[model samples]
Target: MDEILDVVSLVLILIGALLCLTAAIGLVRFRDVPSRLHAATKPQVLGMILICLAIALSLRSWPVVAFLVPIVLIQLATAPLSAHMVGRQAYRNGTIDRASLHVDELAGSSETPPAAGG
Candidate 1:
């Protein structure tokens, strides 16, 4: 059982590391701001979750796991919100490529205030 737990932890840790690396590579490889933001946030969140899981499994401490739960929740809550804000800001500032977007609900929504004097 101990060996199994160790193996599981190692696997999770390795997978998390790979995800982080993939996110890093994507940040560099993706050209558009939205795409880069996707690359930066999505895998990073998953990686963090996986890493937290590995830590919980390895420590096998309920207190430590309890401490980590809120951290995981915070990451889950914030990462997407942060990515959306960044993506929206980039789109508004004309930093993102319009051609890359397939569906632009934001472009058609009243949520985006119109430009002054336009």
Candidate 2:
């Protein structure tokens, strides 16, 4: 159904927009750098991805679909890597506080990640 598909696409777009809004809020309210980076990177990337998908579905042409798909794929592929590298660099540089970090998932991280100049 065209109407159903349109509604679904619209809803996905709205959900993506909401993800972006929450990401912005998290970026502002979060206490430290690592969390902020997580907030800014993951949700925003997902939001854009949803947006791209919405555009692709709406346009429904091979050229447009082909153009949008790889951008989404590349972003989906690379965003986490970018976030990990940046987060690790932040941790190494001491911009993130262990006290504020609820989850420290990175392997071989310092037992006590040094403070911003320790």
Where does candidate 2 stray beyond 4 Å?
Answer: 99-118
lDDT, candidates in the order shown: 0.88, 0.82
Q: Which lDDT tens digits does candidate 1 get at residues 1-118?
A: 9999999999999999999999999999988887788888989889989999999999999999999999999998998899988888787777877777798777765345666443
Candidate 2: clashing pairs of residues: none
Query: Which has the greatest TM-score?
Result: 1
Q: TM-scores of the models, in the given order?
A: 0.88, 0.75
lDDT of 2: 0.82
Tens-digit per-residue lDDT, 1-106, candidate 2: 8777788789889989999999999989998877788898889999998888887777667999889888988888888898887888888677877666667675
Best by lDDT: 1
Give the per-residue Cα lDDT of candidate 2 at 73.
82
lDDT of 1 at 10: 98
